[model samples]
Target: MSVDPVEQWSGVLDRFEADIALAVSGGEPVPWNPPVEAEAGPLPEELADRARRILDAQLESMAMLGKVRNDALAHLDALSAVPDSQSSAGPLFLDVQG
Candidate 1:
C-alpha cells in the first residue's frame, strides 16, 4: 500500500526533529546530516506549526555555528599575526644569572 503524502511529510519532519534533537543533546559524534529534501511538496495546514518549529531551530543552529566559526577564525588570525618565537633574536623569557 502506498503511504499518504501527509504521512510521508510527517515522517520527514519526525526524522528532521530527531536529528536536531540528537545534535542538541550535546553528543560530539552526532552528525548534522539533514534530509536531502522533504519530497512531500507543499506542507499541509495541520503540519505547518511543526514545520515552523523545525525551521526556527535550524536557523538558530546556523547562527550558533556561524558564531563559532567566526570565533575560531578570529583566534587563528590572532595567532598568525604573532611573530614566531624562533624568529625572535632574544629569548622569550629573561634568565637571571643569580
Candidate 2:
C-alpha cells in the first residue's frame, strides 16, 4: 500500500525527534534514513520554508552537540595530563596502635 505524504513526513519528524533526544542525552545518534523519493514538482512555498527552517535548526543543534562532545574530550585530555600525586608518594602503609 502506498503511504500518504503527510503520514510519511509525520513519521520522519517523529523519528527525527527521537534521534535528537538520544543525541542530547549523550547517546549515539540514531540515524533516521527515510527512503527518498523525487517529487514531480517543486514543493509549496510554505512547505519549502518550513522544511528549510527545520533543517537549519537541526544542523544548528547537531553542531552544538559536536562542540559539547569535543569540549568534554578536550577537558578529559587536559585532566589526563596532570600527574597523580599518589604516584609520587611511593606506597606508604600506616598502622594505628591502641
Candidate 3:
C-alpha cells in the first residue's frame, strides 16, 4: 500500500521519539550498566557506539519534526484565510423584499 509522505515522515518521527525515550531511560529494560572494573571483560564498545548513534538520530528526528510541524501550522493558517464557497459566492437566489 502507498503511504502519504507526510504520514510516513510522521511515523518516522514517532519511532525516533520512542527511541529517544528509551535511550534516556538508560536502557532500563535491558541491562545497560557498564561492566565493573573487577569484571573479566571490559565494557562493550558496541553499546557506547549504539548510544551515540541513537543520540544523533534523536536530534535529527526532533529537527525534522519541528520543521514538519511548523509547515503544517503555516498551511493551516493559510487555508483558514480562504472564504468558503457559501461565504465567497453568496446565496444563489436573491431575497425578494416587500
Candidate 4:
C-alpha cells in the first residue's frame, strides 16, 4: 500500500523541527534531505498553512545563521592578516616610562 501524503508531510515536518533546533543551538550538523514531492491530492488547508509557516521560519533562520557564520570567518581572516611582533623568533624589548 502507498504511504499517505499527510503522513509523509508530518514526517517531513518532524525532521524539519529537529533540524531547526539543532541549527539554532549550533549543535551537530543536520544532513540535507531531498525535497519531497506532493502526491496528486490536496492537503488539509490548516496543515498546509502550518507547514508553510514553519518552512518560512526555517529559511529565515538558515539565512541568519549563514550570515553569522560568514561574519565570524571574515573576522578571523582579518585578525590573522594583522602583523604581530610576537611571531618573530627574537629577543623582545619593552619600554616603560612614567
The TM-scores of all predictions, comma-separated, are 0.65, 0.61, 0.45, 0.68
Q: Which scores greater on lDDT, model 1 or model 3?
A: 1
TM-score-based ranking, best first? 4, 1, 2, 3
Query: Can you list the residue pairs that collide in candidate 4?
Result: none
What does each candidate score in C-alpha RMSD?
Answer: 4.2, 5.7, 15.3, 3.4
Please give the clash total of every predicted structure, in order. 0, 0, 0, 0
Off by over 4 Å in 4: 35-44, 84-86, 89-98
State, as a TM-score between 0 and 1, how close model 1 is to the true structure.
0.65
For residue 25, model 3's alpha carbon misses the true position, in angstroms, by 24
* Candidate 2: tens digits of C-alpha lDDT, residues 1-98: 66566666655555666676677777887556665765223334435555676677679778998899899999999999987878866646556684
- The stretch of ten residues in a row with the least summed lDDT in candidate 4 is 35-44
- Highest TM-score model number: 4
Looking at candidate 1, the ten consecutive residues that score lowest on lDDT are 29-38
State residue 74's C-alpha deviation in candidate 1, in Å. 0.6
Candidate 3 global lDDT:
0.59
The lDDT, on a scale of 0 to 1, for candidate 4 is: 0.77
Encode model 1's per-residue lDDT on 2-95: one tens digit a residue. 5577887898888777767766665464454543455566678899999999999978876877787799999999999998998999789876
In candidate 3, which residue pairs get closer than 3 Å at backbone N, Cα or C atoms, i.e. clash?
none
Per-candidate Cα lDDT values, in order, are 0.78, 0.68, 0.59, 0.77
**Residue range 1-98, candidate 4, lDDT tens digits:** 88877776677677788888888888897578654455524555657877888889899988999999999999999999976877867657656773
- Candidate 2 matches the true fold with a TM-score of 0.61
